[model samples]
Target: MGEPLTIHLPDPESAIHLAGPGEENLKLLSKQTGASLVLRGQDLLVSGPEGAVNLCRRLIEALAYLWGQGRSVTSVDILTARHALDTNRTEEFQALQQDVLARTRKGEVIRAKTFRQRQYVQAVRNHDLTFCIGPAGTGKTFLAAVLAVQALQANQYERLILTRPAVEAGERLGFLPGDLQQKVDPYLRPLYDALHELMDPEKIPALMERGVIEVAPLAYMRGRTLSNAFIILDEAQNTTPPQMKMVLTRLGFKSRMVVTGDVTQTDLPEHQASGLSVAQKILHGVEGIAFCQLGRADVVRHPLVQRIVTAYEGHE
Candidate 1:
């Protein structure tokens, strides 16, 4: 092992932010870089093999932009910082650190927290149609919803349309209680949850009534030309090939579409195929389209979620 290296944080506040609550962020740094870290006051001492120590130092430097801004460090930030270092995209990573996509109703700022997520957001901004396929908790649908709402509030689009295939609601929808909406509401709860995070719950119904925002099952999307709107199709992995084709063809003038799904969690029957998978194969090199694939490293939920995804991937 080489001599220990000591880095001084700007202040106690910066030190705390970098260390994270319960020193979890420090633990993550050691785990990731194979270094030993001990924070004493404002000094962070790292000791290990020369290569590991140097890498740990570089990772910390890459994350300086965030902690320098007094922002709290998170697992996502650490993962993205390492990714930026690995890919030599530290300059782009610094740019992304300053871009806030939107703020939540609770006043939390929302931004891309991983390398692939930033790419996905940029893809959505630059392309008319973008598809993001990843495992759960990677912020695929949530980030799309955020961008769609931002476009709507800015008057970039006249309406916002959210749709997904209600896989179990095909023929059994009529047998359920209430009206068509009530029957489909269960299938659309996740989309509603995302909307509620950005919009006030009481105001959402009014928006729906005025047609400013529409949420419906994929079956209701047939025979319609959607224009002047931002459209999102979530849970797309459950859609059949024909259903996917119908929705893709519905895109009209002055509109944008985001398709998000977890291909591994498809609810389709064993004999059926996932439209998301088919579309990826068919439209990969097509112009005016973008496809982003996120992996376990992109998950921004609880840190344990990343481990769970890795475990499942290994089993598969």
Candidate 2:
């Protein structure tokens, strides 16, 4: 609506080859900044409002710098540039950044205000395997499910596999009625809810039937190799150490795994090591493995939920 904004880059013969797919980068930047961007020669033409235009220019410069430095520029970087261009104070933008990071293709960004949600997303994008440890309401399971949905939508993986331990938090699963899925459905419902948000409910059953999406008990993962899949292990604290080893070993080439759990909420009996906890200790310093510990400050739920988590922490 305002004056057109243009950005000119000096022709550096040495950096010309560094452009490497400039059109794609321009498209990505335009999407993030909500500004139409076109490149002619060494000039970038962005026509938008004064503020948005200037912001786009800054973002383009930043992207060129990052690319020139050989740093990977991900979607996160695009969002970060948008945040920096829009806001003067970083604290508010940081909160917004967390929301942007919590975004998934299946649904909108997480509404809850928690930094842990952002860290969880970052871990998933940056690592081959991510361990998200936190208390309830931290959006651990929900965020993981969202990432799985995004991976599927982007065709980054062939399928989505969601697994959780069958162990009841306190009750007995035997007391529940019906078959195995019926018995475990209560535990797996959260995952289904996430999927429904990202995809049409009608499509879910078809995908499940076709094995494009699978919801199963952790025990069923034994003796199988999972390749080209976005695998998520939820409520991992209920798994025993041997079970954890078996599950981790099942990762086939080109598969990414995310394990989410609350260490403080472990239901495992005393003297038995929780697989999540054990993995945290054993996998530390291991290359290609990432760990993200979410604290009470990262809880992105009702205000009361944060207070409740803090009260529990006080008792500990």
Candidate 3:
């Protein structure tokens, strides 16, 4: 129906990377542009209506830009690429390329995957106290953990402190396994998982033994002055106002704190108020503090997880 065009890639060897495994990236590009893509030698043939072909060309160039920057192309990357073009954020997207936060165990870059996430990262970096409230799978805890480890590794902070309220086991905290540490271990497993992802697994034991990385229950934080540390309070919604106040007051000099949670998932009783909810209202306009809210659109987990979050949000 329209003219076909052959666009040759400058680095032809990157075609496979751009196209993804089994030509999946091409499939995604076709879905997005409604253009038929054919890979021939170093050139990709685009066959479709003229507008679609033109859009496809732009997408290929965007993909080329990321690949040229040595970043892997994923389906989410394709979606971000489309969003960038539709919203005229292509240049801003290019700037995001240089903001690598940390790397995972497999050396995968852990930068912000979306514009909103980039804002959260900026807030964490600029503010001494930050609160990120979002649904599950939104990278609220994970990103904070990544930045915490990065700061600790860079010696910006002398230690890393992670804590979360044990809401599910409210009065049963002492009824669990051996000792206090073992009793709360299950509740703090998520923090451990994050640490293992960002820091070396073998090195964690020694670091924890030396108190460089401390993962403990929120109860352990009372009456302690945590200074020169990067502290993260996950699952803050389960905390009460008094607990939040106490922990926040413990923040000492030269320290940064990030509190992350989902108020919607608060397990508190009907008459009880969520500490994070109260903190959101009280600490919002305070200087040196930031609060970032992310929604279902920011969920970076599996596609179905996003859909599930959207469905629950709608039903509510």
Candidate 4:
């Protein structure tokens, strides 16, 4: 065992901020680094084997950017810090802390919470077309929507179109409800939910009416050249090869498209191939197109959600 390290905080209040709510962040740091941690007054005591102590020290340093500024730390912050230390990408990790993607209507700051998520954001920014494949709760759809909204608000794009394959409802909406939107809304609720998080819910109707924002089933994209738009195709795994090709071809001048899905959770028939999978195989090395694959580690939801994803992966 090495000598215990005593790190002094800027203030007593900052201890609680660094420790996280109920000290969950400290607990996760201890678990990840095998270090003993205790907060007393204004000092943090870390004691363990040499390697573990050093890791804990480095992780705390990496997270200093957040807590030092009085921002509350989260489990996602802890996991990301540990990952940055493990992969020797501490500089990139610090850079991510400064890269806020967007703020919610309620004033919550949104940023990439993992290395892969950062890469995904860069991919969306640098490429005209980007594909992200990941499990649930990895912010695959949310991040895309956030960027899309930011670009739309900045006038970078004339319109924002969010679409997904309505495979569950089979796109047979004529029998369902009132208007075209009301009929299609059941399958498009997730996209709506994402928009609501990024902008005023009350303003969404006005935006939709003015064609500044459009949320619809993937089928609605056919034969239309989507120009000057930022488009997000969510739940893309439900799309067949043809549908995927149709949408890819619809990307018109000055338009950007982000396609996100979890291939493992496809609702397609066993014999049918997921468009996402097929696209990955075919468009992988194509120029001006970027593909990002996020694993269970990229999950930024409740920590339990990461464990649940792992458990299901093991069972599968």
- Most accurate candidate by TM-score: 4
lDDT of each: 0.93, 0.75, 0.88, 0.92
Per-prediction TM-score: 0.93, 0.67, 0.91, 0.95
Q: What lDDT tens digits, residue by residue, belong to model 4 across residues 71-90?
A: 77888888888877878888
Candidate 3 Cα misplacement greater than 4 A, ranges: 9-13, 21-24, 38-43
What is the per-residue lDDT of model 3 for residues 1-316, given as tens digits with 9 covering 90 to 100? 6899998766755776777778888898999999999988668899999999999988877666676665667776788778899999988877665678888988988888778788999999999999999999889999999989888888999999999998889837877879877898899999999888887799998998999999988988999999999999999999999999999999999999999999999998989999999999998899889999998877888767888998998899
Candidate 1 per-residue lDDT over residues 72-183, each given as its tens digit: 8998898888878888999988888888999899988799988789999999999999999999999999999999999999999999999989896664688889999899
What are the RMSD figures for all models against the true structure? Answer: 1.8, 12.2, 2.2, 1.5
- Which residue ranges in model 2 land beyond 4 Å of their true spot? 1-115, 169-175
Q: Report the Cα lDDT for residue 3, model 2.
A: 82
| Model 2 RMSD in angstroms | 12.2
RMSD of 3: 2.2
Query: Which is superior by lDDT, 1 or 4?
Result: 1
For model 2, what is the alpha-carbon lDDT of residue 126? 87
State in Å the error of residue 303, model 2: 0.9
lDDT computed for candidate 2? 0.75
What residue pairs are clashing in model 2?
A: 106-198
